[model samples]
Structure formats: structure tokens, C-alpha cells
Target: MCAKTLRSVHEHRKPASLRGRSFKRPTTGRFDINGDERKFKKKHSKANGIVSPMPNGKPTTSKKVNGMVNGVNGHAVVHMEDEADTSSGRGVATSSKYAAIQEQRANLPIARGETHSTIPAISIHDPSFATIGKEALLNEFREHDVTVLLGETGSGKTTQVPQYLLESGLAGEGMIAVTQPRRVAATSLAARVAAEQNGRVGSVVGYSVRFDERSSTDTRIKYLTDGMIFRELLSDPLLSKYSVVIVDEAHERSLRTDLLIANLKTIQQKRNDASQGKGKGKEKEKERLKIIIMSATLDAEKFAKFFPGSKIIYVQGRQHPVTIYHSAQGQLDYVDSAMRTFFQIHVDQPPGDVLIFLPGQEDIESLDNSIRLYANQLPPNQQEVLICTMYASQAPGQNAKVFNATPPNTRKCILATNIAETSITIPGVKYVIDTGKCKEKRYLAKNTGGGFDTLMTRDITKSSAMQRAGRAGREGPGFCFRLYTEESFKSMALSAEPEIMRSISALKTLFLIGGLDQSGEITQLGREMAAFPLEPVYSRAVLASKEYGCTNEVLTIIAVLSASSKVFVDSSEQRDAVAEARKKFKHGSGDHLTVLNVVRAYKDVALSENKSGRREWCRKHFLNERALLEANDIREQLQQTCERLGIDWKVSCGDGDEPVIQSFGQGLAMNTAFLQPDGTYKQTMGQSTVKIHPSSTLCDKKAPTIVYDEVVYTNQIYARGVSIISKSFLAGLGALKVRQA
Candidate 1:
């Protein structure tokens, strides 16, 4: 018997809800089972009086007699042919259900004059949707393939535009993909959109980030990190699945965002060529991919010229006017000024939260302690003050409380790094204290060498200052207390330099991966490098590991280096304890191998315990649990990329740590330095003098030559993560260009 026939028989034998219904007759049908015809009785209900022929001339639906019937006991032998073919008829039922749902949705009234009203009521009531520019925003998309959308923080562009596209049937062919620079923003925006549509997350609206994805095939709109979208390009260069690509927060100008925009231009050109019947097989473009670039403070004219035919749409944000305050003179100590300003606002201003922007985590922590001390001094009857600190490396569980509403009769003071400048929204903030500084990673060329040092702290640009000021007005009319004088503000740069302008090595690596030669010609290696999710430095390291036969260990080292947060947590009070705990993973070679040991130990512990126990284990060892988790995730991704590129990477570590260290030297040979007799180090390339960072385990012990991960300058130039290596190893790697003094 066919599968469907068997299913029908099984379904009939099972208890069902239709027990009260009476059968009229048993229809005549073929008995294909066992290839034999089985005679059965027909039954006719007295009410209906319908009749059918049976071998016994008795009713088939009659109650069993003496528990014996047509070759069976206490069971009616029903023919399979009498049942309707449910498998073939199910499509109609499904289609009808969907049609009814769609019809009901179509009947709902459009919110705020939008073409569709599936979004939340608050979104519809946003002033951007009711503004005069709303129509122009829609019309621009209809006319141009690329649109530069400029709006301030409170503008509804980020949340509403995608829905507008969906309502207009512009995204009917495929999903509308929106990219955010940070993961938190993507996931939060997805939740807000899902709430507006009255749908559960991961259905019509979803988000994807590093190691976390909450999207399904039915997702009509997706919010993903810019890095996530770049990874998608490795698999689908054309991004064929998305009909519309929205790059939000374009003003941030991150490395990934810049590369994605450049690659997207290439994608659009390819699609145009394909549509013109120029490519192999003459496969016409199935859909024309539309692009929308949204930014709070965009360089509109520059972007317009970049995309020749693109149009610019400026939407005024809905925000109350904010009053700005500047110091009478330039304040040399911003931390002191910020503290004074905080108390001033708390004591004089109306009840609202205070947001103080600092340069880095160190500043946030120091200021947070000071604020708490001052809060404790206040009278117990006074309104309570809650202090919170926010930085990228902060634990997520604590970060969630940053957005919670303050309790009645209490005020919240959030001391944060530049992360709050654009990546997040902290509600109920009515006062903003801007230090006019932020920690920016800049590549400073060595005075006498070809290489550069990475500087992690720098002054904020004028554009950044404006973004910081705008945060105060997000909720209501507010005040911005600038720690610097107006003259100092004007002296700042127009905008922070783009990542592309600062990192030449990164650009060179990108070209190499794009298959471009010295003269900028594309090569096969360049193409493969573009697909790797790591920076060119790490990607080159993994690619080179294959030659040294230590790809697995090198991959792990790179993942640890790419951790989202600091792996080591050291505070003044627990410095000795933290150091003692970290010593367990020291491999006696350098920080690089130490990192490998940490990863191995973490994995071993993670496997043997539940998640909570694993967290406790990391805590006991003074390791950042989140950082280790992120590193493990990155390691897995890099390994997958290696496999995809057909690199023969062994899954296990080699016999010893020497081979792995040698492989790392092969990739970072140019970063080698020689130890000077004076206890300072000199770079092999420029003979530049540097000191070993205090954090490096090899700082005290000396070796002739060392390979370092980075050279950063704070009070003095310091080589961090120093690993000692033999002179012979350096010579073999061709890194002994500068003779040891």
C-alpha cells in the first residue's frame, strides 16, 4: 500500500473527536492490501435512508456482534478507498488560512498616514512620519538606487523606513536588511520593530550578530551587525537574498562599514552588468538591489558624489531644543570639571538622569567611585542617587540596568565611555557632561621606520562633540555642560580621520586579499583574504600558519587577541591576587603562548561543568568569562574560514609550543624588536627605542630578540605582549635586518 493509504488507516484506527457522528453506508472500493478482495457489510442510517451493497447484506456501521465481525473482532474493517486523500487536499486548507490572515491585516487602518499600519503605535506617532519630508523620503527611493538619509538621534528613519518599504511592496521580492555598527543596537531595534508589529521576534523581524542569531526563513526584515553583513558577502557576494540594504549609523565610519560600502558599490556595478546581458551565461539580474545610507550627521555632498546618481534626504529629528554650556576657560582636568558639573545638575536641575561621557573605562570607573562617595555624603532623606558605569567590555547583565527607569524620588547617574556617543540610548537622561575627549585607536608612523604604533587615546573631533551634545535632547529639553571652552571646541578637527586613512597595513592586506598586486591588480590570494573575518594582520597570520604546520594553535592565538573585551581583569585592590591567578597559564615564552594556555584551560573547564560552574571557574581564575566566550566563538569562525579555503589545518595542537610561536613569528616578523643593554628595546625595522609594557610577563626577564603584538604610546612608547625568541628564529624569518647593538 502507498504511504498515504497506510497513514489514513492508522489515523482512522486512532481515537478521534467525531465519535458521536453516525456513518450512512460503507462505499464499495478496491482492497489492494495483500492483493485480496475482502467482503464487508454496508450500513444505512435510519434517518438518511441511504443504502449500499455488501456481501453479508448487513449494515457496515452496526455495532459489533459477539466481538466478531468481517474477519476481525471488536474492529470494523473499513476500506482505505472510502477516505478522502488528505495529503492532496491539504494545500487548499493552508492557502485559505493564509488568505484570511492577509485579508484581515489589509483591513487594519494605517497608523500616522503610513501606507501600512503593522508597526507599533508609538512608531506611527513619531513626528518624522508626519513631517513634510516623509513623502520626499519615499519618492527619493523610487527615483534613485542609492539614497543618503540624514537625520538626528530622535529621527524615526532607523525604525520607520524599513516598514515604509515593506508597506509599499518595495521589499516584496526579498527581505529588507538593515545594518548597525554595534550588536546591541541591531538586536534592540529588532525587538522594537517586532513589538510595533505585534509579532514575536525571530519571525517577521529578527537580528543577527556575532555568535548569536535570531532569524528564520519567514523573517521579512532583518537587523544585523555590519560585520555580520560582511561575512554574508563571503558566501553571497551579491547579497542576492536582500532586496534593500540599509546601512544605518553611516556617520560612525567604522572599518567594516567603510569596506562594506566600497564592496556594495562593486556589487551594484556587477548587477547592472549582468542585467545588461554581459556576464557569463547572460544571467539577467533577478532584482535591482536598492541601497539607503542613514546617518545622524552625514557628509551628504561627499556621499552624493561617491554614488553619482544618489540623492540626499534630510529629515528633521523630533527633539526639544537643548541649551549648551561651556567652561569660562579651558579646563585642564576634565574629570574634576565633570564631577562639579554632575553635582551642579543634580542639585539644581529637575529630576532626570545624568549622562557623563568619559574617554575610557579607567575614567568611567574613577569618576563612578568619586560620584558614589559624594552621593553617600548626601542626607539620607534626600533623593537617592544611583550610579552606573558603561563601557564596551562591561558585563551584559550590568549593562541592561543602564536603560531601566529610575525609581520614584531617585536619580541615576551613568558614567560611560564613548560607547554611549552613538551605540546606545539611555532613557530619562536630561543632562549630558561632555569631556571633549575620547579614546581613539590611531596608527602613528614611527619617526625613523616604515611601521606605525597604535595610540589608543586621542581627542574627540568636532563631529563627535555634536553627537555627544545631541544625546541630552533625546528625551526632552536638556542642558549640555561642555568641559572645554568654545575656542577649544573650534580648534578640534572637522571630523575624526577615517579608519582607511590611518591604517595602511590594513588597506594593503585588503588589497592582497582582493588579489591585487603591487600595481593594484587583483590576484587569487587577495580574493581569498577578503572572505576572512579577521583583520589583514590576523588573517595573514592564519594563512601563513599552514606553511609552519601549526595552523590550529595560530588560529587560537588570533582568536584570543580578537577578544571583545580584556581577558585579564586587574584592579588596584586585587592586583596581586589577579596576577597570581594569571600565572597558572604562563607558558614561560611570552604573552602569546600564555593566551593559548588560557584558551585550552577554559575549554577544558567549560566541558566538564555547566555554564554557571564555568563562569564561576573563570571568576576564580581572574579571567574575563565573556572575553573567553567571544574568543572561542571567533576561533570557531576562523577555523571554518580556513576549512572553506581548503587549508590543511590540523585540528590538534602540535607536539610543543615552539612550533606555534615560530608560526606566529612568521606572520608578525616585521614587529620584531631587539633587547638593548640599557633594558629598553629597539625595533628591528627602524631601530626605534621602546620599553616593554608593565603587563607583559617577559618584561623583567630579558631575551636577545622578541616578537611583539603591538607598540602603544601612553606616557612612553611600550611594546605589549612581548614574547622572547632566539636570534636564529628571527634570522630564519628574515627579521634580523637591524643588527643587535
Candidate 2:
């Protein structure tokens, strides 16, 4: 599942630009029309500098909040409130505002620690529904170990049954953490449930996202990301605090979700004895963990068999009558035909936003371009529909717009990835167009080695098609147009493959972190890695940082690279700036040394000014302030890892440029390459004929040389590869190979 909440770096301040150079930050000024000379939350804004917060699912523009713009470089200081009130006071009262949600959870005939207002619940009273459905399901479930949940959209099983366990108190004080594949659902559902219980959101119905957190100790019904819940397992093996764990959006088959199910099964076989729990009152906390799996169209029967004694409850969704249609014309000129179909539906049919599914990023971009270009040519009456794009790679501001409503008389079009499939709930999506395609990432053959990573675009799975179809039928009777044939849909995979079996695992990461064997089970050092809230590789980097006394350095890199908080200034000027950076390092080594040399130079420059000036100066050099922030996080994690190993991270930050190469080489040792007799060098683990990316330092020059810069494990070798040798080693390796040449 995707991360629930990605942090916002720019909220109000405008990105500053300088003449004759790239964007420059405030080096000395207190305010450049924006206060405190803070970094911009967004760039290229036409609006005056005003920052605003989106609180009620409504989109608002920048207007300073309490005199503060949600500036990118601004610190996110959680307004520490009275923990009690902040935890549970307003959730129940506020949740009463929604009628449908209130009817489902609050009005149910149930017992609880606190009494809820009496309201009648809508029940499925069909005789057939009661007799053959659940009872028949029980018999099928009794004989199975894993089950797939197959139900239409609006299935009550997703939300209601989790409450079934809660009301039964089968979960006990042990928490029931349900992981949603998307953030909006996690946060919205958490608030809805908290309000039902007459408690605060964070208290009993809390959600823990990346930047926005609303969970507290009183919280018993917690909603989190699939990955977040998975990581939590490493911290609490038996999940002693939670009695029931629900994996929502199982059809998505995200990488972490797959790992979570497998890990859960692993834990179940060798159940962690309650007596072994690290938490206090551990044994008394030993409660049977309940596994509840829910999905829109999953094969629930199969999943039930996977876990013997597991029960599957199917709840029908509130989906309205939806009519499916195929494009009028055949395959050729289909994109144009698709637009005509969309235009006809928007004008002749009804008023609601349109959800269009495409193969991948390229397809989404192509379809969106066509729509926008057509909008300009349309009549004045047709030009009113506000067109927007939605994809994972989109900037933060753009993604937010897809969820908000369009102005009156204007229709909004949402172009999304499979991410829009199940977890996210977009209002007004009454029309859906399916492309029957999705981009998938997979590893190439090991014989090709690490250099050739393949990004294959494949046909959508059957579950993906159902998910796309469900998007249209949410509000009322809607229309869906399919680009492919029904036969093709039937031939598709039953479900998207699970992630763990497909993608790269932390085998290398775990090996380094815990020194574990290939299985990634615990090792001496890995024991500490298991305690961290990050992936094994990320944890290993932190541990290694401590050993090298570079704790401060690693943290900054991680925070910046993490992409969530950074404004992600993809400036073309980074290459030019590196050229300038090398001038300070005396060009004694290579690009790795260039970064170290430049960072030191920047820090020294900062010492002459305040931290505010430091940020401004960084932007001027095409450097990212947020990257520096992440680097600091990586450093701190490393420092902590070292302390756990009884090592003090007090070593001074080093400055010698030549020694820096050797330091980088040890861990990046696997990246090293050697020149062959014919002058072709092998670099990748699979030794594909790879070349450096244009952005790498090695790409700028060529000799009888083997350099490491711009490396990836695709079907083809790429650039920006990092190597284990210094520039001097290049000369030595070149000498031996030059004779062969």
C-alpha cells in the first residue's frame, strides 16, 4: 500500500530565482517578501504569498495561517495539545455529522465500554442471504487455510466485520490494526470510527500516517498503511498489543501487503509465546490473533482455506446501478475515439468527474495531453470543465486537486494509476474509462546481473479491472467504457501478483544489517535492525553510519532522498553546480569526493551565516535543503545504531578528499568494474555491457578506463553508476588494460 501521508515542504513561500543563475535561496535577508527568509512551500505560483491549510477535504489556496505559511523549510511542530482532549474528545461528536457513516457503526445494536446513541441499523434480511451465504461460507472456510474475498464494490465486509470482532471483544485490549492501501481512506475511516465511539480520533480510532498523526494510547481501533503495519510486525513479533489484524485492499497485492501476509503466516506457525513479549504484562496479553481479510472482488474462498478456521463475511457495497460500454470504434485511432466518447458522456449524459485508467505514466500523460488540447478547441460552453491529472509522480499540489471538487458547471477528469483502484475514494467519479494496462516493475534474470532492471508494462489483472469499474459506480448510477474486449478481461490474471515474490528483497540489506544468512532471518547485527521502523537496507545504512562515526551525515541523505518532504527541485543545473563543486575539491578524486567536498564547503559557508542563510545558499547552488534534512535523519539513525553496539559516534567529520573515496568504496565495493582486453568493462553484478549515465562524472570523459557512475540493474546498463575505486585506481586499472587494447 502507498504511504498514507506524505509531508508537505512548500506551503506558502514562493521559490526564489536569481538572474544569470539557477534559483537562489535567501543567504542573508530576513524576508524576501516572505517572512524569515524561509524556503518556499511551492514554486512558480501566480498567487500572492499566502499559505492555507486544507482541513475539510476542501481545497484552499495559500493564505498565511496564524501568520505562518506552511513553508517547505518550516518545521512541522505538532501542536502539542492536552493529550487527553487531543486524543479523544471531539471525534464522536464530529462524526455524528455524517448520516451514512453514523448509521453503520454508531447505530448498530452492540455493547461497548461507553454507550452510543441508539439508532437502527440496516440489516440484510433476505432469507437467501442468511441461509446459503454465510453458513455456506462457513463450511467452505472450515477446510481451507487461505481465502480470497470476492464481493462487489460497496461490500460492508470491508468496514463492518472488523467492527464485528471489536464488538465481540474478541480482540480484547489487544488492538485491531487494519491497514488500508491508501491514506485518505485510513484518515477518513479513522475519524468516522472515532466519532462513532464518542472518543477522540487519535485516542481510540487513530491513524498514523507519515506527517499527519492522530493516534493515541486510548486508541483501540487503529488504521494505518499496509507497509506501516508490516513494519510494526518487526517491532512487535507477536503483535502483542493487537488481537485482530485486517489487511484491506488485498486485491492490490502491493509489495508490503504480500510480505505482511506471509510474515503473519510465519509468525502464526511459530507463534511468539506471550511470555516472550517485550511489553509489560506480556503473557496475560497472549490473545489469539484474528486475521480478517477483506477485498472488493478477491477470491475469498481461496484465502479462507489458507488459514484453517478463518471465517469470511461478504458485505455488498452501496454501488449504484452502473452500465458498462465499449468504445464505439475499433482499436485503431482509439485514443481519439476515447476522447470523443468522454466528451459525449460529459455533455450528453450527466454531471460528474470522469476517472480514466491508462497503462502507465506515459499513457496517462498522453491521454491527458489529448484532453487538454481538445479543451482549447471546444466551444465556450464546453471549455468550462476543469481538467486535472492524477498520478503518483505528480507534484503534491496536483495530486490534491484531483480529490477536491471542480467549480460549478465544470467537470474534472482524474487520470490515475492503479493507485486509484481501491483505497482512495474520489467523489463525483460517475464515469470511468479503462485502458486495460498497468506498468509493473520486475527484476531481470540474475544471469543478466544487476545492471539491467526491467520496467515492463503489462495487461491489467482481473481484480484491477473490477477496481477501475468500481470507481464509476460509487455515487449513483454511472457509466463505464472499456477499451479492451470482455474476453481479454476474462483471460487476465485472477489477481495482481504479491510483491515479495516479485521485487528485490532486503537479502543484501539484511545480510549487512544483521549479518544474517540469505533467508533474512535474525543475525547478530540484524537483531538491532529488526527494532527499527525502516526497511532492512535503510536500517543497515543507519547501523553502518554509527560504525564509521558519520552518524550526522547519513541522516541528512535519507531525509532528502525520501521524496516525501522534499520539494524535489529537478533542476538541470545540478550538473553545472557539480562542476563548480569540484573546483573546491582540487579534483583529487571523483564525483563521490565532489559531493563531500562541496557539502563541507557549504557547511563552512553556513558557519559564517545562520541556518536560514544556509538554506538560501543551498538553493542557489541547485542544492536541496530538504535533502540536507534527510541526510541528518540518516545520520542520527546511524548514530543510534552505533550506540546500541556500544560505539560512540563522536568522530570529527573528515575533510581529506582522497580518503573519502576509500570510505565510499568499502560498502559500494560490489559496484567495482574492470577493463577487459577488448576495452569493454564489466560493472554490474550480472556484468552487462553498461555505460555511465550522461549525468555522471565519468560520462563527461573517457579513457582506457573503468569508472563507476550512474548504475542500475535493468536489461541495459545505465549511467550515474558509483564504483569502489578512486580516480587513481582508474589510472592503475587502465594501465594494465591499455596494453591489451
Candidate 3:
């Protein structure tokens, strides 16, 4: 009944903010909203990798064959365009602007097939085309239930394997499912694959990411983020609609990817058993599922060990020999080092684009500005430089600029997080500069799920180092300049910890949200919780709202919290003005109610104003209009979910805030804290000290008892999405009914 909630959770897919999962961000000094550069005190943690200061930053398959476990390798990057409000279709029947967008896409540098296009006819130099014959590759997959395919970056495997299954009829009447670790990878790869197929998106090829879906009944092949697949499982546990499921970038081992890998194994067994007549009726002849686990590194032995009888195959990629050079000594500021190296390549080296890998976005922006400043100082004789900054949080339109063809006499310089290390391939990149660092999110697990997420800068792994260097050779022989000494490179780890081992386990979270019973079984409440496309915690809040008679307020608050974008606009130059504007919606109850106030204000304006007027209102308030629109969409979906579940979403408490706060308290029981005598807030469950995030409306304010959405660590452990509540409300939370599955 709550299925609409689950479906709508991912319906508004602007790539989610870079949080929780493993992605890239920045390191070193970050600019505050007031334009002040505060030096980040590096906090070290033993969890993920070695969490250290600025010096750096920075799945599955079975087979029986054996060999020494070597380093993992692979490279695939996405180029998803921002179309939050657009349809999944791409033909005339699609959005009116679809054609214009398609035309613009055709001009992208990589789309020209000058380097590593997956289409065989357009990519003659791609290694997969040269060595791995389509028929032979299909034969391997045909003979094996699981095949661990190890290929290097630019191998064309990520984009080619799905098409092979589709054209060969290996997928039968069912769809071919490909799972990527990131949303951008799924969407961009879908667009590229659709272009290769000569069919409109949502027809023959499409993608499903959080809040964004672009597929139709005619779609024979689909791309989805790992998390999207999990939601699909809640409805189709058997994955009956797909004949083949390919897990790409298996080596990254993000938490979701790992969980997905394990689940796929179980699914394969059940489906194969059914197809063999192990069950009755329709289950007796089910379509057997085929799983292909693809990784960039040659270390397929681990995957082989995981799946009995699975085969391991290595395909050579199109990468050419890359000359590597390391700095004589460590540079304290890799950003400055990167700037000097870019000029070295631009002024003295051969002509080609340059890619500089940083730890995160803060450094990317820092380097972007630095490069432009120096480029302007160069003589007329030197070529002009075009700098593009790429990160998870960047606007889709801006990230797309990295794929544009370089202007005449202009050198393209891309400053990016480790996202450039793999998630995409930019044509004509001949020089690579590695800062030897990246930002990572690690869950510091403690008792009671009071652990916080820390985004710390650490050295890149050895495998990552190889991947970064491989970017230089996408098309031809290239050069890699390492900012650290070779000795430091050897000291790096072979790969990152599997996300499951480092991050909080799904079971713990599910249990805390009342989705599971003590016996580790899914509860009836959990089933209902899964029906909504929200985190278990948020879904629990919705259920709790039923008793509070404040479903309207609860849904509104949660919708904004669930949106992918931030509600407030952050501008350094207008910091003071932004704060002043934010005061209009300030609530003594803290950020959560402040958000409700903002939403209420937006709704009032929406009723009395036109589109332009609404936009003007948002601009004047220093608010993000896109976020509000997305939140409104989420709220509508939640309302529909509530209706289907027989919960009256229209019921509201009007001016009373107590019932609403109580409902949230039930969901946030694991996330609540109380003010200590020392003036610091200590979590009720874990007793860990936390400060309200600076962006929170209640920052530095004393709230006797507070409930927070999450804890994020930068220079300090800070709680975000803060709200005040009564201790008696929390004490009465146990009175809420718990149902079993």
C-alpha cells in the first residue's frame, strides 16, 4: 500500500548530494560562506583507509580458476546532463526541449567517438573491439552462471556487455539489467548507450536513479544505480523481469554494491532452481538469471573464490603505455603543486587536454580559480586555458562542459575529485596530474547507531593511483605526473575497504527503524516501510504520523529532508543577506520546523504568484527553487502513499507543533541527544558529544533535548537537521505499537 512512497523516493533524481556513499569531495582549506578560508584540521581515523591530513585525499563474482591476487583496475565515468523536470523519453513525443538537448550532446568531445566509444563501428581502437570478440564473450557468459570479467579502463565493457546480451537474444523477452555504483554513471551510460542503439531513450534504453526514471515498456536494456535495484527488490524480489544482471565496477565495493552482490547470488540460486523444476506451477519454469561481475583490475581471484564454479576472464583494454614521474619530495599544498604542473604541461609539453585529480570539490574550485588566474597572466603566444570543475554536487549542466570540444588555441584543464579517476572518460587527455589524495565518508559506528559520518582526506590506494594514471592513456601514449614521491606510492594500500565492512550495516539501521524484529526477520511494519521510497527512519516517521494526526506536517518536513538538493542557497559574497533572509522562516524548534516554515511560505507564494513570481520570491529569499519544487513533488508522492495506506494525509494539527515533534521523535529515537551541563549536546543513546552544524538554524542555541537527522564530520562532529523536542515525548515514545511481519 505504501508502494508509492518507495517509488517516489527516487523519482526526483538530481544526483544525490555527496554523502553516505563513497564518492569524491575536496580537502585542505575550505571557504566559509563569508569568504574566509579556514584551514581544516585533519582528523585521522583507522576505519576506511588511513584517515590523515591534506597529504592526500584519498564486488562480486565467482569463478574457480586461480592466480595471484593482483591490483584491481577499471575506468568508467558518467556525463549525465541535468534534466530534473524532463521526461525519460527522447523523441518528438518527449519534452519539447529534448531535441535541443540531444543536438547539444552530439557535439560532446567523447561522443564523437574519437577515443573510447562503446559502439564498435565508431571505436576501432577500443581494446574490446580488437581482442574480445562479441560472439566469444557471449559464449563465456552463456556457459557460466557467473563470470568475473576483469578488464582495464576504456575496455568498452561497461557499455558493450548489455548490448551484446540484448542483440544476441540472451536476455530473452526480459530486460538486461546493468547496475552502477553512482547515479551519474547510470544516467550518462544510458544516454550513451541509447545514442549507440540509434533509438530514443526510454524506448530501447533508459536509466533509473533516485528520483529520476527514463524507461518504457519497450526498453530491453536498463541501467540503474545499486540503490535503485534494492527498491525494485522490495516489489520484485525475484527480479523476474530481467534475464541478465551485470554488476559494473565491482571492485569499488561501495556498501550498496556489496549488499547487491550478495543478494544477486541468492537470486541466481532461487531462479535457477525454479527453472530446473524445483518449484511448482509458474515457478517451475522461471527464467534463469545470469550474473556478470565486471572489474577493472586483474584481481579476479577474490571474486572467483566467492562464487563456486564461476569463470574468470581478463580482457585487455585500449590503454597505452603511460610514462610516470614522481615529485622529488612531498608538497604540503597539492593544489599549488597541481597549478604549477598544469602550466608546465600547457606551456612546455605536447598539445592535449590535462586532467588534475584532487581530493574533493573545495580543492577543485580552489584550483579552478588558480588556473584561470595564471592563464590570464600568460603571454598572447600561449594557448588560452578552459577550466572545468567536476564533483558530485556540481550542477549537471556545468559537469557536461568537461565533455565539450576544446576551442581553437585553447587547452582544456579539468579539476575534479577522484570522479575523474574512473566514472568518466574525457577525450584527448594526454597529461595526468595526481594529488595523491581524495575525500571519503566513513561511518564511525558506536553503540545505539549514534555513530557519525566523517569526510576525511587520505592517500589514494595503489589501485586508484593506477586508475588515475590510466586516464592519460585513453586514446594514446600519455604521461602521468605524481605530486608525491614514489616511496609514498608504495606505502599506499592496495584497495579501499569494502563499504559493508566500514559503513554501518543495513541490518542495524533496519532494526533501529523497526523494519526488523529481534530475530533478524523483516517485520510487517518493515514491509510497509519498504513500500515507500524513503529511508527506513523517514518511513517510520510517516507511519508514526498516523497516530499523531499530523501526517500533513510530517510528510512536508520529510519531503524537504529527502530532497537531493539543499533548501538554502549558499553564497559567500551575500552571506549576511542570506542569513537575514533565512530569518523570515526561522523557528525556535530548529532546522526541521524552519524548513516547514519555508515550505509553508513557498506554498503561499505559489498560490498567489506566477512561475516568474515564485522564482523571484525564492531568489529574494536566498532559497533554492529547484529543491522546493523537488520537495513539493516528493510531498505529493508521500501524500499518495499515505492515502494508499489508508492514512489521512490531509489531517493536520494546524498551529500546534507538539504532535508533529512527537511523531518525529519516534522515528529519530536513535538520533536524539540532550544538552550536557558543559553546554555540549550528548547523544542519548551513545553519549557522544556533538555540535549543531553551523548551517542549522539552532546552531549554538541551547535546546534542552534535541533530535537531529544526521551527524557529519568535517573539522568536528556536527549534527545537521536539528530540532528541539520535549523529554516527556521521548519517554512516551515506547508506547508506540510495534507490529510483526
Best by TM-score: 3
How much is the lDDT of residue 255 in candidate 3? Answer: 79
Task: Put down candidate 1 lDDT per residue, 1-741, tens digits, no spaces.
Answer: 223332332243212442222211212232111111111111221212111112222213212111111122222211111121223221223455445433422222211222211112222212243333445456668768888776644345677788888878766567999999888777777766665455666888888998889889889899999989987887899998887899987776778888888888888887766667654321332456789988654355566667887766655444444556666666555664576667667766689888999887766765675566556655566678899888876655566789788999999999988878765667788888888888776677645453565556567887787678767765455667788766676677757777877765554434423336657775676666666777665676777677777888888888889887888764545778888898899888889889989988988997899999998888778778888878878988887888899986664455466777776665566678888889888876655688889899888788779988887876678888878877888667442342211
Most accurate candidate by lDDT: 3
TM-score of each: 0.75, 0.68, 0.75
Cα lDDT over the full model 3: 0.71
Q: Which ten-residue region of model 3 has the weakest summed lDDT? A: 59-68
How would you encode candidate 3's per-residue C-alpha lDDT over 422-496 as one tens digit per residue? 656777898889999988888866664446788888998888887887677655557778888767876888788
Per candidate, the number of residue pairs that clash is 11, 79, 34
Q: How many backbone clashes does candidate 1 have?
A: 11
Q: Ranking under lDDT, best-scoring first? A: 3, 1, 2
Which 10 residues in a row give candidate 2 its minimum summed lDDT? 1-10
